[model samples]
Each structure stands twice: as structure tokens, then as C-alpha cells.
Target: MIISSAEIDSAVVALAPVMRRTPVVASRVLSEQLSADVWLKCENLQRTGSFKPRGAYLRISRLDDEQRSRGVVAASAGNHAQGVAWSATQLGIASRVYMPVGASIPKISATRSYGAEVILQGETVDEALTAAHAHAEESGAVLIHPFDHPDIVAGQATVGTEIIEQVPDVDAIVVPLGGGGLLAGIAAAAAVHRPDTRVIGVQAAGAAAWPGSLQAGEPTPVGTMDTMADGIAVARPGAVPFAHVSELVDDVVTVSEEAISTALLLMVERAKLVVEPAGAAAVAAVMSGQVDVSGRVCVVLSGGNIDPLLLTHVTTHGLSAAGRYLTVTATISDSPGGLMEFLALLRDLGASVVDVTHSRVAGSLRLGEVQVTVSAETRGPDHQSEVREALAQAGFLRS
Candidate 1:
């Protein structure tokens, strides 16, 4: 069935009572820098920490009494699994979620905690999907696909509806693409109502299948995927999504892992918003200059379920990029005040020492030379250079 703006609007209305009307926050810094009115749809704060819950709950709610009694099954890498499990549990229906073995621990635990039977299967989403289908067939359960169903597409379109209502004059909507449920939904609504408003889709450079698919005018799968943005790491787009994306999406671009990391960190530090890598892909595209969005832009922050360890790494990566953290080695004289002198120089240069490592390793330094590896936090790159120059002028050459 052809999913139109009316169907999307109806789905949004249907989901109004169940799903949260996620807020849209303006980005002052990004807007000033990009010379545009930038707004961010904070779907990351939605139920299950992602907008997937909207579509999942909407689709599950549409099932008949008999279908609901039979239960539902779905395969997902992470966010979608949690959405299905949580939605099913809320509806008092049995649910089974098949997730890849390497899926994040938090997602696995969250799915199980939501009163769903969680199955760890295969190495990829496709493999898990195959297993989920087999289980559904054998157990007489309905398979709720993550992105390939009509209900799902219509349900996800609610995001578009919310965006337009939240920011009526939005000139462009940049969405992250995985299997394209979200993108297709947004495109369908924007194409008809806000025809003048451009809709751009972004994909991780590590898994850039959309560009190739657009060129070929068909769905094309990437042989391999490697990126931190697992949410948009689909090897190819869905059939329905491919059609809409090819026709409605104005431009499809790709962003690198570094850009995604920076975007995540910036959201946390600058915007005070916690966003996962997948959810930050749209911002990644604009921040990395992969796309030119100079006018009013709305970026969809899809999810915020990043692993703690990865979040820590992204934060440090951001600090490094901003030159707020510096790691350097210096050779010092083996004297009583040598360490004090080195530290004094750093203090004089206005650098706050974060970590210091001193050693007398053989090849790295002479017997009487002390190798000091100092990590300091500075204001910016200029302050970092000032610290480096101070160490150099104090007869403590960089080791």
C-alpha cells in the first residue's frame, strides 16, 4: 500500500497517547556558525531512549486480537529490539527478540528486562533476522520487522509530522539512513506538504550504501560494514524506502567515523545533549561539511543508547580534537629539582597537568636522563603550543 502524508498523520495521531511528543530544541551555537536556524528533534529522549518505540508500538497496536494473542517476534542489533520488547510488554503480548551476539550488553539486558524472551543469535542482523523468521514460522508468531513493513514506515513518519509542527518553516530535514524506515517516512510527509523544503539523508561513510543505491535506482547492499553508528549501518535500503528515498530525498551524503565521534561529543559538551553515534549521524554530516545546509535545518537525533565505554572514548576524542588535552614526552636532567622545574614550566605556561608518567627506560633516554610523559589540559591548541614551547626553552627537549 502507498503510505501518504495523510496515513502518516493518522499514524501520528494514533500514537499520540502512547508515544511521547519528543521536544525540539534550538541549536544556538550551530545556528550561529552555520548561518541558519538549526533545530534538533530530541527523539533520543523518547521511550526506550529512541524513536523506534513509536513505530514498534504503533505497528504492534495495529495487530488484531488473534495476532496479539499469538505474540510477535523481531530481529535487531539493538535499539529496535528494545523498542519491540518494551512495546510488546506494554500491550501484554508475548514477544521474542533476536539480537546479534555482539550486540551491546545494555541493549541485551534492557530487552530481557522488558519482559521479552531475548535470543542471542548469529553475527549480524541479517543472520538474526533469518533465525527470527524461522522461529516465527515454527511458533505461529507474527514477525515485526525493524523497518520493512508498511505500518512501520507510516509509524516512523510521525517524526516528520512532529518536525513540521514543531518547526513549521523548516527549510531542510537531515535524517540518518539505515534501512530507511525513518528517512522514507520523513520524505513522504515532507515531499507532499513541505514540497519546497529539502530532505537530505545521511549515512556513515563506513556503510555508504544509499549513495550507490540512489545512483543505481535500486537497493544495493554493501559487502561489509564498519562504523560506530550501528543504527544506520544497514547494508542496503528497503524496497519501499528505496523508492521514496530515490524520489523524495534531495541529497544523500556520507560522514566519517571521526565526524560522528565529534558530533556526539559536541552534543554532550556544547548542546548538553547525550546522543549515540547512530543518532548523531545527521549532525555529523553537517558538522563535517559533507553537506551544505545554510538555511533553516532540522537534524533528527534518533537515539541515545551508547555504551558507557564508547561514550567515554568519544568524549576524550572530542577533547583531543579541541586541543583541550595534550600528551607529550620530555627529557629532563636527573636532578633533585628537575621534576619540579619541568612542572614549574608547565605552570608558568598556564597548563593544568592531568597525568604524569616518569621513567628511565633505556632506548628512550640516557642513564642520567629522565623521560617524563606529561598529559595536560589546556585552553586550546595555542595554549598547548605554549606549553610545548615552555618545555623546549627550559632545556627539556621533547622526547
Candidate 2:
């Protein structure tokens, strides 16, 4: 189904009072790094901690009275589950949400908190979706897909309308792509209102299907996906959204896992924004130079509903990627003060020790020799190198 700008405008008007008008701010750090005017559409601050609510609410609101009475069912990794649950509650309708078993704990709890029946099934979203479909068919509930539907696309297009109004001269807009509803909606809106604005879609390298699908001239499912950006780890693009993307979107690119974590870290430290790995995909593309940012660019931070444990892991990985965190296991004498001497060397090299462990019974160690494992926070790659060099000079060989 073709969703026009008028439909999006109507969705904007219908959702005006329901949804928050998420802010757009200039990213001075990103601007300087990319040598372009960089802006961030902070959808991470949107209701339900994502832009998903806009689409979710709109789709549910359009349902007939019977459908509303029958309730709604949805499948999601996290953000969409929360959105659907929140929307159903707001509309005074029952909701059943099917989420992947590995979905974030916070999201699952949040969805249940919103008064939805949360069912954890399958290891991936595709599997969860299958379960959701079966439930909908059995229970006579209206299945509200995360993407694919025309109403969902029209609702998501509201973001583009807001962007056009906020950034009148936006030369390029970068968005993270999952099943492609958000990208398709924004691109369609841009095609109508700001034809000159380049609409770019970003996907995690591990889960990217658009590049191959586009090349094949059809929607193609990936056999395997391995990425921390679970929000965008869709195996295939939705048929409805793919039609819009093929015609309206300017380009699609993929970013590495390292880049996604780095972008997430940068947002926390530099922008003071809590963004999920999937939400940071556009920024990751910019940081990795995978997208053209040589113009007035706006990168959408799609959601912030990340689990605390995952956030910790991503932050640590990001620090390691930036060369600001180092872990080394070195051979040291089992004699007293051996561990202390190794720590002293690290301190002298200006590396702050975060953790230290000594193992005397390691197979790699000789008699009276122990292995000292140390994790430290350094300034950067250079500081890490200096610390390693200092350790080597102190007769400590890294294992």
C-alpha cells in the first residue's frame, strides 16, 4: 500500500496530543568530526523510549471497534513491544506481546508494566512473530506487526514531517533500518516535502538485508544474523516497507559492531544521551565514514530502551575499541609483592588499574611463577601502548 504525505500529515495531526514532539539538537562534536553540520533527532526521548509509539498508536487507533474490542497482538524484540503495549493501554484495549526469549529484561518488564500480556518465546524476532501470528489467529486478536502495514508506515512518516519543519534545510537524513518501516516512512515523506534531502538508511553489518535485497530486486532473508544491535537485527525487510524504500530511499549502508558500540559510547559521553545500539546505527555509519555527511545532516537516534547489562557490556567494548581500556595477563614471580610491583608499573605509566587477579596454578606458568591479569583504564591507544611497553621493560611478558 502506498502511504502518501497527506496520510502522514493526518497521522501527525491525529497523534499530536498523544506523542511527544521529540527534540532535534545540533551535535557539535559530530559536526566537527564529519566536517559537516550535524544534527540529532532525539527519538530516544520519545514516548516508550522510542519512535515506535507513533506508529503503534496510530495503527491501533485506526482499527475498527470490533478489532479494538478483540484486542491486539504484536511481535517485537523490545522497543516495538513496549510501544504496542503502551499504545494498547492508552486506547483502553487488551494487548498480547510476543518477544524473543533473549529480548532485554527492562523492555519485557516495561511492556508488562504497561498492562500487556508478555509472552517470551523463540530466540529471534522472526520466531516470536510466528508465535504472535498463531496467537492472533487463535484468539481473534488483531495482529499489529512492528512494520509492514500501511498504517504503521504512515504513522512513522510523521517523523519526517517533524524533521522537515525542524530542519528546513536538512541536506541528508540518516536513519537506522530494521524491517524498514521507519526508513520507508521518512523517505516517502522526504520525497514529497524535501525532494532534495538525501534519505540514507543504516543497518548493522551482521543483520543487513537491504543491501542484498536491493541488489536482488526483491526482499531477501538473511540466513544468519550476529550483532548486539538487536533492535535492527531483522532477517528480512517487510514487503510493504521494501516497496517504499526501493523507490524513496537514496542509499543504504552497513556499520560494523565495533562502530555501533563506539557510537553508543560517544553519545553517552559526548551528547549525554542514552542510546541503544540499534538507535546508534546512523551515528555509527557517520563515525565509520560509511555514509556521506558532507552536508547539513540529521542522524536519528531511534531508541534508548537498552538493558542495563547490555549497556555495561557495550560501554566496556566501546572503551576497548577506542583503546582507552586494556586487559593483559602477564607472567610474574609467585614471590610476595610480585602483584604489587606489576600494579606499581601500571600506576607509573599513568594507567589506572580497574581490576587485578593472580593465578599460581595456571598451566602456562612454571614452578614458582604466577600469572597476573590486569585490566586498566588508559587515556587512549598511545597510553595503552606506553603501559604495555613499561610492563615489558619490567620483565613482565604478556601471556
Candidate 3:
């Protein structure tokens, strides 16, 4: 279905009372780094910790009395589930949500707390969605498909309206792309209001489907999906969003896992924003030199409902990727003070030790030698080099 300017305008008015006009804040750190004035559309602070609720509410609100009476059913790994559940509750409609068996406990709990009857049904989101469709058919409930309908797209367009209003001179807008509702919706608003403004879509390289689909002139599905950024790890592009994206979007780009982690790290450390990996995708594009354009750029921070465990893991990975964390192994004399002296060398080089392990009886160790492994924190790539140089010069680092 075609999503027009009028439809989006109507949705903006309808959603204003229900949805947040999330902040568009200037990022001084990002501005100093990239050759552009950068602003973040912090939808991570939106209701339900993402932009999902905006579309969910609009889609549910459009249902007729008969459809509303039948209630609604949905499937999601996390953010979308909470969004649909919260939207349904706001409208006083009964809702059921099917989530993957391995979906994060926090997300499942959040979905349930939003008043959804949570069902653990399958091993993956696709499988859970199959169960949701079955439930919808059997129970006569409305299926709230994430990002596939005009209402969802129009609902997501409200973000675009906010952007145009917030950053009137924005040269480009970057969005995290999954099913493409948010990207297409923003592109729609940009098309109608600021035709000169560029709208770029960023996807996880491991699970990207847009470049191929755009080339094929239709929605295309990928054979396999793998990514830590669960929010935008969509294997297929939705048909409805594809219609608008193929025509309106300026460019679609993919960023690597390392880039995403680093971007998330930067957002947390530099901008002080708790953004998920998917939400950091656009920033990853800028940091990794994937997005070539520059001006008053606005990167949409899509969601923030990350599991604490994941946050810990991703933070470590991010630090490592950014050269702020390091792991090294070396052979030292098997004497009692050997390990302590080795650690002293690291301390002298300004590396803060995280953990250290020593073994005297390794297969590769010489009779009077010990194998020692250490993980340390550094300032950046240069500091890492300095530490390695000092270790090697001291004859403590072997090959």
C-alpha cells in the first residue's frame, strides 16, 4: 500500500498525544570527529525504549470495532513485542505475544509487564511468528505484523516530521533498517517536505537484505541471518516498506560487527547515550567511513532495551575492537617473582591489568619457563602499541 504525505500527516496528529517527541540533541563528540554537525534522534528514550510503539499504536488504532473486539496477536524477539503489547493495553484490547525460546528473559518480562499474554513457542523469531499466525487464525485475532503495513510506515513517519522540524538544514538522515518501516517512513517525509535532504539506511552486514532486494527491484529474502544486533537483523525486506524505500531512499549501507560495537561504545562513552547495537548502526556507518556524505547529519538512535548481560559482553567486545582493551600471552622464567615482574612491566607501561594467568607446565614451555596470559586496558591503539613494544623489548613477549 502507498503511504502518502496526507496519511503521514494524519498519523503525526494522532500520535502526538500518545507518542513522545523524542529529543534531537547535538553530539559534540561526534561533531568534533566527523566533518559534520551531528544530531541524534534519541528514540532510545521513547516509550517502550524504542520507536516500535509509535507504529504499533497507529496500526492498532486503525482497526475497526470488530477487529478490536477480536484482540491482537504478535511475534517478536523483544522490542516489537513490548511495543504491540503496550499499544494494545493503551487501547484496552487483549493481546498475545509469541517470542522465541531463546529470546532474552528481560525482553519477555517487559512484554508481559506491558500486559501481553507471553508465549514461548519456537527457537527463532520466524518460528514464533508462524505460531502467532496460527494463533490469529484459530482465535480470530488481528495479527500485528511489524513494519509491513501502511499504517506502521505512516506511524514511523512521525519521526521524519520531527527530524525536519528539529534540524531544518539537515543534509542527510541515517536510519537503522530492519523490515524498513522506519527508513521508508522517514524517506517518505523527507520526500514530501525536504526533497534535497538525503535519507540513508544502515543495516547489519551479516543480515543485510536491502542492497540485493533494491537491485532486484523487489523484496528479497536472505538464506541465513547472523548478528548480535537483534533489533535490525531482518533477513527479508517487507513488501510495503520496499515500495517506498526503492523510490525515496538515497542510499543503503551495511556496517560490520566491529563497527557496531565500537559505535555503541562511543555513544555510551562520548555521547552518554545507552544505545543498542542496532540503534548504533547509523553511527557505525559514520565512524567506519561507510556513509560518504557529510553535512548536518542526524543519526537515529533506534532503541535501548538491551539486556544487561549483553551490554556487558558488547562493551568488552567494543573496547577490544576500539583498541582500548588487549589480551597477550608470553613466556617468562618459572621463578616465583617472574609473574610479578611481568605484571610490573605492564604497569610501568601504563596498562591496567584486568586478569592474569600463569602456568609453569605448559606443553610449549621450556623446563625453567612459564606461560603467562594477561588481559589489560589501554587508552587506544597507540597505547596498545606502546605496551606491546615495551613487552617485546623486555624479552617477555615471545613471537
Q: How well does each candidate superpose onto the true structure, as a TM-score?
A: 0.93, 0.98, 0.98
Candidate 3, superposed: residue stretches over 4 Å from native? none
lDDT of 1 by residue, 268-383 (tens): 98899998999999998888787777778999999998889889988787677777888888898888998998888888788889889988875868778998889888898898
Model 3 RMSD vs true structure: 1.1
Put the candidates in lDDT order, highest first.
Answer: 2, 3, 1
Judged by lDDT against the true structure, how good is candidate 3?
0.92
Question: After superposing candidate 2, which stretches have Cα over 4 Å from the reference?
Answer: none
The window of 10 residues in a row where model 3 has the poorest summed lDDT is: 286-295
Number of backbone-clashing residue pairs for each candidate, in the order shown: 0, 0, 0
Best by lDDT: 2
Prediction 1 TM-score vs. true = 0.93
Model 3, 306-395: lDDT tens digits are 899999999999999999999999999988798889999898889999998888788988899989889999999999999998999999
Clashing residue pairs found in predicted model 3: none
What lDDT score belongs to each candidate, Candidate 1 first? 0.88, 0.94, 0.92
